[model samples]
Target chain A: MTLQIAGGLLIIAATTLIGWDFSARGARRVRDLTELKKSLILLKSQIDYSIYTLPQAFSHISPRVAAPFDEFYAKLAKDVEGGADAASAWVSAVHSLKNSNLDKTDLENFAILGMSLGAMDSGVQINSIDMVITNIDDSLKRLLAENPKNSRMYRGLGIVAGLLITIVLI
Target chain B: MDITVVFQIAAVGILVAVLNQVLKGAGRDDQATMTTLAGLIVVLFWIISYVSDLFGTVQSLFQL
Candidate 1:
């Protein structure tokens, strides 16, 4: 009986934690998207006011932004420093990044942020920012609609599942 | 054979139902459904032995 109780507690803890994690993924994505928006706006302002290049601008802005984005932006800056072109550096950074919640559309949109950077004039650069921001907005809307629902569902599922499993095993 | 098992099942049912309703109010319909199902299954499993024993007693009483 003691062993069964211990097993039940363990199942409950593990399943609840796993379900919470599933829910957190959605929250993480939301955070990343909002942070991306913030960082991009910062990048645009920095570029508009100064003669700073992409690397310097990214390096300047990376420190102030949140994680995953900060790391990815720093890597992009380093890549540019290492002589990779802006596009390649951005692509490599996006591809090499691990532990991010951003999906393929996000990665593609970020790639768009890079593709046109330094390859065009200031007007076009602003346009690229606008484009990525637009994409982020669209994603945010869909994510907001779907993720909270899923997150809550997953949490409830987790606890109930653990209880059921415990009863079955005992 | 423990009578406490029945109480435990009832407790789980009550808790799960409350949780399901809370989750639903919070806009988590999927989780609510899952919690309800889990509560049902767990209660069913907990009572399966007693139920079978009940059937056995009835069968003997009827001499079937």
Candidate 2:
């Protein structure tokens, strides 16, 4: 009789644990979806920046700007073709730029040269870029704050199940 | 075996799973994955000890 009671408790515990696992998985899926959306947003920003900022910044600087822009364009092209997600591909492209291979650093250096150029244009582009980056960062941070409530709920279920099983056994 | 052991294992499993998800949601993918894997291994180890004991008792009873 005691063995039967023990077996019953074990079965109950197993079922409750499985339930918790599935719920946790659901929470994780939500997080992944949010990340995917953010990645898409960043990709769009990169494309917009390239289209608007590159040409204007290039014309402002010496003719040497074309080469770095070409490299950035090429990297973006490869990532698009490779079907890598926006965030990962952009990060890789940025890393390539950082390596100083060719004239890659030229564009970043241009930005770093301060809003001096942008400020000259009433800082419109600088303000816009800063705003978009800030928004994206904030969105990602918010998404990262989510948590799976499955474990907490499961712990409660376990306690309840444990009590019920104990009562049955008694 | 005591009922407390079963409760303890269940509690730990849920706790670790929650920890894993929390870390993962916070963008700590590697740590989240590690926490889950570690929890699984710990639970398996705990189970193995019980199975071993059961096997020993059975063997002694059968004198095999």
DockQ (0 to 1) for model 1: 0.18
State the displacement of the C-alpha of residue A78, model 2, in Å, after optimal TM-score superposition. 51
List all candidate RMSDs to the true structure.
4.5, 16.4
Q: After superposition, how far is residue A82 of candidate 2 from its true place, in Å?
A: 57
Among the numbered candidates, top lDDT falls to 1
lDDT of 1 by residue, B4-55 (tens): 7876776677678767776887776896898688778868876888899999
Q: Which residue pairs show collisions in model 2?
A: none
Candidate 1's TM-score on the B chain:
0.86
> By summed lDDT, which 10 consecutive residues of candidate 2 chain A come out lowest?
A101-110
Weakest 10 consecutive residues of candidate 1 chain A by summed lDDT: A161-170
Docking class of 1: incorrect
List clashing residue pairs in candidate 1: none
Best by TM-score: 1
Model 2, which residues run further than 4 Å from truth?
A1-170
TM-score of 2: 0.28
